[model samples]
Target: MVRYSVLASGSTGNAILIQTDTTSILVDAGLSGKQIEKAMHEIGVSADCLDGIVITHEHQDHVKGAGILSRRYKIPVFCNQKTWDGMEHIVGEIKTGYQEIFCTGDRMEIGNLALESFAISHDAKDPVGYCVFAGNTKISVATDMGYVNAKMKQRIIDSDALIIEANHDVEMLRIGPYPWHLKQRILSDHGHLSNETAAEILTEVITANTQCVHLAHLSAENNMPVLAHMTVKTILEQEQFKVGQEFDLEITYPDKPTKLRSVRRR
Candidate 1:
């Protein structure tokens, strides 16, 4: 079995602690080492117990503190060659040469777990999301996506747990205070997923074994927790899916750290 928790999830920073029977991996260390340590401590895990750090992209919100955390903890950083090239200047060189490079379709073994990276519709050089397997359970982390493609949909199907993006509400963003260019970037094909778009995709991929739905990367100014949750809940309900029973839904935060989530296995 595998145990996991979202130490924090949002635009400010993001990090998830994934632990199997023998291995522990931190996915995206956007926060400082001290902040990550505090979050880990709250979840009853120590920083020294971490085995690796998996990066999704080279964006500042996803890799801001990646270098500091990897250096301080002496943990390996896994990402694609293009992603590495884009982030090398930001994260500097990995001292131990543990910077494992992998492509979108490549699969790697980390302790008892198997991880596969898949391409996502994002503006980065080689932005990708992850699907990890521990024992018989599968967990997918796919935030920062502009839209869901056919390949992405296939990758997320049958996932035991999913952490997808519900970045903004279209109405809220259209009338929000952001500049025109920023708004354009956000609504572009390479931008984040809107609430309606995420729900539509979930209807196509969600299964009976899908135990949890973690809504991540919400826009602080353009989105509200109540609206995001209500929009998703209503859509699922319309499809005859019951919340907290058939599936669980949650909205992740932007400013404060969230509790470590548990990934239940079948």
Candidate 2:
């Protein structure tokens, strides 16, 4: 059994908590140390209960509070070499005693959890997503990526639970107030995922083993929870996949945290 919680998910910040019987890993720490502590307590997890913090990229929303939390709790911080370079300033500015860096694609064991990293298409230097296994169940998270490549799709296909990005709606983005260049940047290969793209990916890749699908990293100005959910739900139905009754679909907010989701593999 494994438990997963979305502390926060969006451009403002992002963090995920994955725990098994013997391991507790924090996927990212975008929130401040105090906010992270509060969210952890809401999910019935204490700071001391965490084994390590694995960062996805060097983006401010993902790395802002990581070093602070690591120094405060003395928890190990794992990230790729390039990410370390990008974050050296922010993380190094703070005095941290606990830090262990690893290259992308390396697998590491933290207590009972086995974590593997896969490259992702994002604007940041050396951005990657993660797949974690505990016993027979798998929990995968891939957000802040532009599009789902073949490799990303394959890695997430067999997971029991998936946290994927649905960043914006095409129409909203085109008409929104963001500058033309910024909009173009967001639509590029190394940008964020659109709602339609996310729907297509989920409809094509989700299987029976997938118990839940969380729509993450939504753009507040360009997307609404109702829109993202409806887009994916409609696509899944068109593909002859049952919605709600067969599997659960959740939407995470930038300001609000998601309920702690538990997975049981029989």
Candidate 3:
């Protein structure tokens, strides 16, 4: 069985914990070190037990606590070369041996899990999402993306569970309090994914084998959890798919941790 939890998700911060019986991995550590430790403890895991940390990009909301976690726990941090270059100064000092680099499309092993990073359309330099394979189950983490392209769809297809972005609602963002430029940046091709777009992408990639969908990276100012859930649920239902029967849908919170979700081979 593979256990997954979104320790925190939103524009404010992002972190995900993926674990197997023998291995534990953290996808991003955007929250403070103390906050990350508390979230991990809530899920019955310790920060010291983490095997490694895989970073997606150089953005502050994703890399804020990465350095502290790496230094404190003596865990390896894996990221693309570009990401390493872009975030080295911001993340502060990481021990030489702990700073590891993996190519975007290549696979790397950490304990019992095989991790593959795939390119994502985001504003940061060489941003990517991760797909983790454990036994027969595959879990994909694909947040901080503007849109899902063919490659991204291929990467997410047949996943047992997914943690994908449902960042904002188009109408709400358009009429909200953010300045015009910020709104436009968020609506750009290299910006965050909207709730409707995420729903559309899920329709294309969701399969019978897929067991769970986690709507993540929500915007507090522009999106409500209920609205994001309803948007995706309504779309799936319109296509004659039963939500609870076909698969489970969950919304991750920005301020707290979500219950651990497990995917096991049938």
Which has the greatest lDDT? 3
Location of the lowest summed lDDT over 10 successive residues in candidate 1 = 253-262
**Candidate 2 overall Cα lDDT vs. reference?**
0.87
Ranking by lDDT: 3, 2, 1
Instruction: Please report how far candidate 1 places residue 240 from its true position, in Å.
Output: 1.4
**lDDT tens digits, residue span 19-99, model 1:** 886899988988777888888898788988888889999887778777887888888999999888988888877876878
Q: 134-159 in candidate 3: lDDT tens per residue?
A: 98799999999888899899999889
The sequence of per-residue lDDT tens digits that candidate 2 reaches over residues 1-266 is 89989999988889999998778889988878888888889878888888899999998889878888877777888899899899878766434446677888899888999999999999999999999999778899999897887988988887889999999999999999999999999999999999889989998678888889999999999999999999988888898888887789899977766888899653
Q: In model 2, what is the error at residue 109, expressed in angstroms?
A: 1.0
- Candidate 1, which segments miss by more than 4 Å at Cα? none
Estimate candidate 2's RMSD in Å: 1.4
Model 3 scores what on Cα lDDT?
0.92
The TM-score obtained by model 2 is 0.96
Listed per candidate, the RMSD to the true structure in angstroms reads: 1.2, 1.4, 0.8
Worst ten in a row by lDDT for model 3: 257-266
Of models 1 and 3, which has the larger lDDT? 3
lDDT of 2 at 210: 85
